[model samples]
Target chain A: MSYELYYWTGIQGRGEFVRLALEDARAAYTDVAREEGDDVMSAWLDGEHEGALPFAPPFLKSGRLVIAQVANILHYLGPRHGQVPDSEAKRIYAHQLQLTITDLVVEAHDVHHPVGAGAYYEDQKTEARRRAKEFRESRIPKFLQYFEKALERGGGRHALREFSYVDLSLFQVMSGLDYAFPKAMSRHDVPLLRALAKRVAERPNVAGYLASDRRLPHSENGIFRHYPELDA
Target chain B: MSYELYYWTGIQGRGEFVRLALEDARAAYTDVAREEGDDVMSAWLDGEHEGALPFAPPFLKSGRLVIAQVANILHYLGPRHGQVPDSEAKRIYAHQLQLTITDLVVEAHDVHHPVGAGAYYEDQKTEARRRAKEFRESRIPKFLQYFEKALERGGGRHALREFSYVDLSLFQVMSGLDYAFPKAMSRHDVPLLRALAKRVAERPNVAGYLASDRRLPHSENGIFRHYPELDA
Candidate 1:
């Protein structure tokens, strides 16, 4: 049975992390919200249909099981798709790294919506500018340094010794940050991460997906938005 | 073998979620950082020790296996301590709820540190005020309502049908929010969540721990900080 993924359709937001893993593994899945309208995603959020109720979208349904949270979804898919090691210890290690990535993602989103998620970006531009300054100056470098050190420890090929979902996620996050803060990212030194993103993109299945129409472009409506003022 | 939990002293913080489960199960574990000193925690963060490297603290070491992240630690301890269901699907569901709680905790922290975690809370008072306004007005109510609806769906006892680590975590989040924003939380109506918090507090092991010296008081340095002006 094909896995069914439900998320917002317009941009490569949090859902992209999960999508990248499925595509990298050449797993057959359906992007439910993209095929069926936003109403279907809204209905699940409203609890109109039943399984395990997700607080938000980007949930996966496979047979009788449903899972939410990007890391959790990847955790389930990792071993099945040969993206992560089989040992219990390595699995936990991969999860720890993924959780840290999740932290970076939250911080990235907060740069734009520091004051509020419900408010418009125009309304919170002042606070966003301040938040983005700190993000570019401190957070981005610190997080990149952590990933760089991890990559070095793992022999500079993947997040672990071999290719894994964590590597795929790191690639997606790097791409998003590069798109959102081209000047800042270029100024910062993250050679290891940049190399990993290029490596992941060249994978046969990943390259095919990126070249195909299934991949969505980064837009302002998503988590990583490029407002020129926030970059500097 | 006893578990070794490494976290900062003086504040419940993220470590409390793991502590509550260990305490609730009457499991034998050593609070290493509290017993030792900050140096021990610092060394781990600096990657001086072996095993999987954690980007930060609140990591657990069980024999040769080491795990980090609050949710990941709880996910490891839940089934081992009889705090979660045995089925894979239920375990995944419990994890999803715990991830939601993690998201809420991040928001609570951001209310005080809107600009950057490296800076002092007093330095970002202006941004804090704006962030807190949005948090108190929309984020808290929406999160509490989501938990309330989850509790209602689970028969008003726990986040799941049975007592799980998710319940322990929900209780901690509610207590922290109450201490941080007594005025705002009191004004908001989250009857189901409030009731669940009370229920979890009354559990035998939970009550014992709360009455013991191990239960640290909420302080300004922790994730949930009480700044009166921001609350208003």
Candidate 2:
């Protein structure tokens, strides 16, 4: 059966990470929410759907099991789709790296919602400006350098011995950041990560997916947003 | 060999989640950083140690493998320590619940540092107040209600089929929230979670650990900090 991926319709958001993996694996799947309005996704969030209850979206339904959390969804998909190795140690290592990416993603989202998600961006713009400065100066470099080092340690190509789902997610992160913080990212030096993103984008399936209508562009509606005042 | 857990000293922070699992299972382990010093943990973070490098502490060095991320560490420890069942399906379910708890924990920390981690709480007091209000009004109850529903679905006592690592983490979260926002939590309704916390605390092994000096008190230094103004 084709995997049923459920997330909000408009923005790529966290759901893109799952889409990238499925796309790269050439796996058959349906973007349920995008195809059939968000009411379908809302029903799942309201606990109308069966199986595990997700606190938020970007959940995947494969057979009877439904999984939430981007890293958790990727962890399950990695081995099954040949995105990660079979070894237990390697799998957990890949998950650890993915979790680090999750941390950075949260920070990226918080830059615009610094006062809290309940408030509008316009109301929190002052706070976002302060938080974004620190994110661009310290947080971005720290996380990017860590990924660069991990890529180096894993053979300067893939994040592990072989190209895995992590590289795909990293590819998404680098792309989102570039779109969101072009000026700030231009000043940073992370050659290995830059190269990995380039390699991931060139892969046949990923390249095809990127050109298709399936891939959504980044905007203020998503986690990584472009606010000229918030970037360098 | 006994597990060597590394985390920052003084503050229970994220490391306490790993510590709870070990204590509940009565597993032999050393709180390495607390005993040795921050230098040891810093060296590991600085890539001076072997195996996969950690983004931050609360990493466990078990024989040849070093694991990071609280949920990932618990996913590894749960089965071995008899904290979770043997089935892969049940284990992943437990991990999914733990990941939800992880989300709440991050928001709890952000309440006091809404402007970013680089600034001091005093420096960001204005923003923190705004963030904390929304956290108390919405985020806290929303997460607690989800856990309450989860507990009800899981047979009303533990977070899963049996007393697992997820339950232990839930207990920690309940206690931490109560410590950080007593006034707000008092007004909220989460009977199942409150009862679950009590039951987890009364567990023989968990009880013994809590009574000892090993369990640290909550304060401003950790994630769940109580600033009177931030509470209801």
Provide the TM-score of chain A alone for each candidate, in the order shown. Answer: 0.98, 0.99
Report the C-alpha lDDT of model 1 over A1-232, residue by residue, as the tens digit: 7999999988899999999999998888999989987678777777676667788879999888889899989999998999998888889999999999999999999899987787889988988888898899988988899889888878888888888999999999998999999999998777888899999999999999999999988899999999999997
- lDDT tens digits, residues B106-151, model 1? 9999999987787899888998898899899988988888888888
Clashing pairs in 1: none
Candidate 2 per-residue C-alpha lDDT over B1-232 given as tens digits, one digit per residue, 9 for 90 to 100: 7999999999989999999999999999999988989888887788877678899988998989989999999999998988897876677778889988888989999999998889899999999999999999999889988888888878898778688999999999999999999999999888888888998999999999999999999989999999999999
| lDDT of every predicted structure (CA atoms) | 0.90, 0.92
Interface RMSD of candidate 2? 0.8
Worst 10 residues of 2 chain B by lDDT: B85-94
DockQ of the two-chain complex in candidate 2 = 0.86
How much TM-score does chain B earn in each model? 0.98, 0.98
DockQ of each: 0.81, 0.86
What does candidate 2's lDDT look like per residue over A70-90, in tens digits?
A: 999999999898999888888
Q: Which ten residues in a row have the lowest lDDT in candidate 1 chain A?
A: A43-52
Q: If scored against the real structure, what TM-score would every candidate get?
A: 0.97, 0.99
Query: Which candidate number would show the highest TM-score if scored against the true structure?
Result: 2
What is candidate 1's local distance difference test score?
0.90
